[model samples]
Target: MARLAPSFGHLVFILSLLQVSVVCQTPDNVNSLLTNLFANYNNKIRPVNDQSLPIVLDVSMFLFSVNAVDEVNEKLVTTGFLGLTWTDDLLQWDPTLQNEIFIIFLPQKDIWKPDLVLKNGFKKLTEMGGDFYFLSISNFGDVYWYPYEVFETRCSIDITYFPYDKQTCNVTFIVWSYSADEVIITKSSGGIDFYEYEENSVWTIVSTDSDIKKDSYESEITFTITLQRKPRYYVMNMILPVVCLGLLSLLVFIVPADAGEKMSYSVTVFLAFAVFLTIISAELPVNSESTSILSFYLVLQLMIGALVLIISSIQLRLHYRKSSRGMSKFFVAIVRIDQFLRCVKRYRLCCKKDVTTVENFDKNEEEQSTELEAAIEWSDVTNAIDFLCFWFLLLVNVGLTMFLFLYITGS
Candidate 1:
């Protein structure tokens, strides 16, 4: 009985060692597993026997950040992580041998992968990430792929309501040449996810959504992201200055014509408006479908400024001209209009003492004097004309500015 006990103890010890060795075994190499799964893999053909067994392609995106929205180039640059998954029945492995594995290979690998690509990409697809660019596989023959990419894509921009415009941009994924019978693209479980968001200086992300469209020949997965422009900078730098200049232009009418700087001041303000127009043009897109309301407002102000320049020239000429030889009736009409408006009442008060001391200060001379005061009466006529025009132009400027900017911004 003692000899039998020793032999049994030795046998039990040997079995325990064998179990430990198996438990601590090194996992299988991913390459060896791939070799076993795809011993007869054909990269050129679909990994299915029946064409009716459509290759289901699942796609998802994690938007990490927005790099830039280039208005000049009409492109949207973004950085994000994209994941793809498909199943290949031919690559199944026994879970008892190896549960799951993740491996990465160039697109030119031996195993079959769907030919999915961005439809509106502006650059070629190139690997840009470290360890995260890889493929995952389960024992049930399901294949997963994820890659991080940063690139630009074409986008249509509308600047009609600019600085307050909402833009919708899309990133679409589709099978390059594969048909519906072979490759069927669909959104993954969560579809689209925003992993992180950072506030932008010039634009704000409003919302995001996804949709899938299938046709007889192909399928598509598109992600829509909406963004709005930050208007504070535009209002402060571009809008406010031009509007203030418009108000300053009205002062050209109030400046006394005899000051000798009225024409020069109008010219200076005209040039200032021109400079602001150039600055705004540089910031806005040149080839968009619709022009900005601000551009229209600038042009309107420029036209009014030009008209005021012409009027200032006329008023200055009338102030200094000494020839009243043949226009007696015109001078008489001018005196009547100025008297009716009471535009020169303060000037008369200052000259009252001089009039009382004159040798022949006739009371009727003040009421019926045509030739006696032709030069002075013409000057008053110019002032009366400027006063009326000043109030009219101011109203037009204010009303037009309010209608164009505020109404469009709210809309």
Candidate 2:
């Protein structure tokens, strides 16, 4: 029994030490501190003791992730938390009094905070922060509040150079109830904190800026985030395919007139361009203020396709004409130009030692000259049209493609 008494005393001593440690670490005076702090507190009133001096609130943001950028609707959705700090004279306490409580957290509803709201919200305005959120109050009257939210704000989309474009979006915030004279909002030392930011797949953050604009009526802070599109997806799927199709349309002149496929092939390609244009239009906003250069380029290609179909029909008509009908002067001139471009040379007979050989050569040369001097046939005219049209359309396609892409990239 005597040995057991000392062991029991040792166990009680250890338990007492643990109790003291916990009491020191946990701030047992929190309940009393809160009760005293809010006993005479009025949350409806600003936490300033002086009625003449305004409360200076510092504002900042910590970005978490970029959810989505809706171009058609011109909206930017982001997940982040707003950092707000201000001096709350009503909530201050002396840490040395009543067990040295330095910091206390109170329900955000129980304390006085700036009535901040998103001024440029895409949807209707609503109060920020949930009922469960809390505000941290320090011994010296500094209050810190972090309200996390998924903010959807209005952002004007300029898709003039879409898929290779950069956009600047602003999320504006203001104190709805308080005027600039009552609550002066200032940007924090760190305008925006990107330490917790996650990269987005479609858009890359190029830069960020914050501006605090003050007027006689109110003060507002705008956070601007510039994003550049990662264009590899559009380039591979939309751009490359459209360019290849445009070049393929020029192949109509390559098909022989008698092949019976020229008309159908040209018509099919023209329809394909129409389908692609429709698809692209559906993706973009139907706004007339600004137009995408890619859309213009597509329209030009479609026109070229239409022209190819018409020329194909004419070529087919000329090709089937009866040989009895002589070719027009215009047709003969086109054939001659085509022949000159192809470096076709006239046949000339050379002198031979044998009289019989000379005579035979002269007859052959005279016959060849007569055939050359004869009127051009309908077949020859159609062939010349095909050759000229192929090269002409090919140059046009190449020029348009190169100019469109180069201008887009440079811009």
TM-score of each: 0.77, 0.84
Off by over 4 Å in 2: 1-28, 189-191, 279-281, 324-326, 344-373
Question: Over the stretch 179-267, how does candidate 1's per-residue lDDT look in tens digits?
Answer: 88789888854345878756678887888888988988988888888989889998898888888999999999989898888999999
Which TM-score value belongs to model 2?
Answer: 0.84
lDDT, candidates in the order shown = 0.74, 0.82
Best by lDDT: 2
- Quote the positional error of residue 97 for candidate 1 in Å: 3.4
* Worst 10-residue lDDT window, candidate 2: 348-357
Give RMSD (Å) of candidate 1 vs. truth.
9.9
The true-structure Cα RMSD of candidate 2 reads 8.1
Clash pairs of candidate 2? none
True-vs-predicted CA distance for residue 202, candidate 2, Å:
1.8
Best-fitting candidate, scored by TM-score: 2
* TM-score of candidate 1 against the unseen true structure: 0.77
